[model samples]
Target: MDNLRKELLRPSAESKQEVSGKVVSYFAILLIGGLVGTILIFLTVKGIALFTGNHFSLREFLTGVNWQPGHHHFGALPMITTSFSVTVFSGLVALPLALVVAIAITEMLPSRVYKFFQPVIELLVGIPSVVYGYLGLTVIVPQLRQMFGGTGFGILAATCVLFLMILPTMTSMTIDSLRAVPQSYRQASTGLGATRWQTISRVILPSAKSGILTAMVFGMARAFGEALAVQMVIGNTTVMPKGVMESAATLTSVLTTGIGNTVMGTAANNALWSLALILLIMSLAFNLLIRLVSRKGVR
Candidate 1:
């Protein structure tokens, strides 16, 4: 009878343990979902309040070029164009170099050489944004000014700073992605009489396409949202940039520049919030694009 009772209690204990695990998992899911939902709702409500309280027209906010709050003009086209241009140009400059560095680390360099240098490269990631901004201000800006003759703080300056900032992130991601490719694929390519370069170009890279693209998207996102570093170097001019050497303001720069001085609930404040809304939208769009690319790669 005692032995029978022990067996019965053992099953009950196992069942209780399983129930506790399920409960814990469900709680975690709910917590994460609630946090994300709350953020979305808050941004939406604050963004809409800008239009309702300030009576600012959505069309003018999106299309107008002049952003002088003193004159009651709140057009943000110039800032939008500047931000887009800086982000695209920076990505174009950084992606190729990042790819080359990643490939060299994984394929070309000796294992000991990579081990010695990997930490040095990753150290770039730990450096503060303010430091990057200061270096750009002290070094890059003056060089550009002397070389091209503008304020020296223009799209070019910003692009150069952002390229350096994003390079570590892109290269790190690319290296991890390349390393994740199955070794069997490389062996198979070699067995088929393909050279090392051919295997890398034809097999490994194609297999890792999704991850590489994801790295690019992440780099672009970083460039898009960068504020203090880019702001310090980009001259902060509220004009549409006509050339790469022209000074310009990005959406983040405008927000940071104006938010401190403007009164809460005013039209100017509301417009800044609207800019925040645009930033959120762009982030979501990039995330969606990454998911689509990943899914296609899986298929």
Candidate 2:
């Protein structure tokens, strides 16, 4: 009778556990959704306040070059150009190098060697952004100053720092993508008389295209959103940079520098919110692109 009672209660206990687990999961999901919705609403309202409340022309804000908050000139074109330029140039420099390193680790290195290096890549990712910025400010800046001219705070310097910052992420993701290619695919490629290099270049890389693209987009997002490291190297100048070597401000750098000084509810403050909104929108776009690539990969 005791054993019979225990057995009868077991199923009920299991059912209760399942119910509790599902409740917790649903609660977490709702919590995340609520947080995201709140942020979107707040940023949207504050971002458009500049245009609606202050009556600033949206066209001029998007296309204008001037950013003098004191004189009420709030054109954001220079910051926009600088942000995109840095993100692109950094990704261009980092992606190929990351690809090469990832291939070497995934396809070339012994299993033990690869295991040893995995933590090293993770360590690079874990390093604080401020550390990278300090290194760039102290090391890369001086070298650039010696090689070229000016204060060595410009798009080039920011790009160099961001390349290092994003490299580990890209490399790790690329390695994972390449490794995800089926072993049978490699065996079949080689069985068909393809050399190892040919197998990797033709079969493996093409198969991992979507994953690599996703990695690249993630890297671009990181590069675009980075503030401290970039702010440290970028000169924070409001003018349109004529060249890579010229000092200029990115949207993030400007926000970090200017947000603290301005009074709330002013046009200057709303302008910063607009910049934040731009960043938020771009971040969403990157996430959407990743999801699209992933869906295509699944198909």
Candidate 3:
């Protein structure tokens, strides 16, 4: 009788476990969905409120080059252009170096050397943005001033600092992507009398192209969204940049600098909120691109 009771209780316990797992899974899904939905709703409502409450036209907001709050002009074309220019230039500067470093670590470096340096490379990711900013301000800015003869604070300084900040991310992602390429492919390439370098360049790289592109996207996104470090170096000028050495302001920098200064519900404040909305949309677009690329790679 005791054995019979134990058997029945075991079945009941198993059923309970199954039910609990289902409940937990559903709860987790709901929790994540709720959080995402809340964020989307909030951003959407606030962005719309900016236009509704302030009577700002979206076209003028996007096309306006001047961003004077006191003058009642809130053109963000300059900021938009600066943000794209800095992000693109920084990514361009960092991507090749990152790829080379990643390839060296995975393909050329000895196991011991690779292990010793990989952690050091990753440690860079943990360094505060302010530290990078300070370093750029103290070290890089002065060098630029001496060499190029400007205030030493401009798009160049911002781009260089952003390059350093995004390098670790790009390198780490590229390394992982390269490593994920099947060893079988490398072996087959080698078996076909291809040189190691040729194999890596043609076979491994092509196989990992999607991931490399994803890494570049992520790096560019990091460059685009960076605020504190960039604000510290970029001259924060409202005008469109005339050259790489000229003063410029990014969307993020403007938002950060102006948010506290503007009164609530005012047009200036609403414009800043609009900038926030633009950043959010940019991030979402990058994320969507990454997902599409990843799916295509998998297929």
Candidate 4:
């Protein structure tokens, strides 16, 4: 009778609800995992078709400087080099400035000023990439021509445009990172007789290092993936750049400009797929790096 009474009083409906919730959660996870796996497999198959189907030497594909697809020359080294150069140069220019702005908004400024600045930075992120590209074309290119001489379409022009495009991203993310540093850290530093600058430099910044790195990685990813804007200012030249001011092509610029012109299953199409595969791999690498950094930070 006691057991029967206990069974009668039990919340069986709660257990059923819990089981349903778990089922839904597991379904969602599996669905997403399957989608990602399908995409990866598709890209891998298509990308490798360039080498396997076309019989193009992988070494030549990577190291060759010429990219005349119609004539059977498909050296991608110039585009690869230019991509890295632009990504690196833009990140170099944007990171320090972003750090300064983030610190000012998060740590140094008054709350009201911080509020005002935060929305402004967010606004920058919402602006269309084409608008930025147009501005670079109309305003930045001519200025560069006057200041440095050249057609103003080169690695430097692309770098400047990317710098502006990425600055807001880095700054907003850094601000969130700095703000995520516990108030206790600041209190502890102050209690230890540290000055404001010393506390921020030694305690807060160090604590937020992983997040800052993640922001920079994300910024680099954005710069690397950008196509239309970069193509507009980068001169879309297929040759290796002799200098920052010389016309150069990036993987994205080449792919965007040429992909639509080629027929399906052709070497040209496969080559573009290879470029896209490179981009996918880089994006995965960045995500993996962020996970590693986050794990280390937790440890």
Best by lDDT: 2
Cα-based TM-score, every candidate = 0.93, 0.96, 0.94, 0.94
Q: Please give the distance, in angstroms, between residue 135's alpha carbon in candidate 2 and its true position after superposition.
A: 0.6
Arrange candidates, best TM-score first: 2, 3, 4, 1
lDDT of 4 by residue, 157-250 (tens): 9999999999999999999999999999999999999999999999999999999998998899899899989989999999989999999999
Candidate ordering by lDDT (highest first) = 2, 4, 3, 1
CA error at residue 226 for candidate 2, angstroms: 0.3
Score residue 144 of candidate 1 by CA lDDT: 93
lDDT of 3 at 104: 89
State the displacement of the C-alpha of residue 70, model 1, in Å, after optimal TM-score superposition. 2.3
Candidates' C-alpha lDDT: 0.89, 0.95, 0.91, 0.93
Q: Model 1 — TM-score against the truth?
A: 0.93
- TM-score head-to-head 3 vs 4, winner: 3
- Which candidate gets the maximum TM-score versus the true structure? 2
Runs off by more than 4 Å, candidate 1? 1-18
Candidate 1 achieves a global lDDT of 0.89
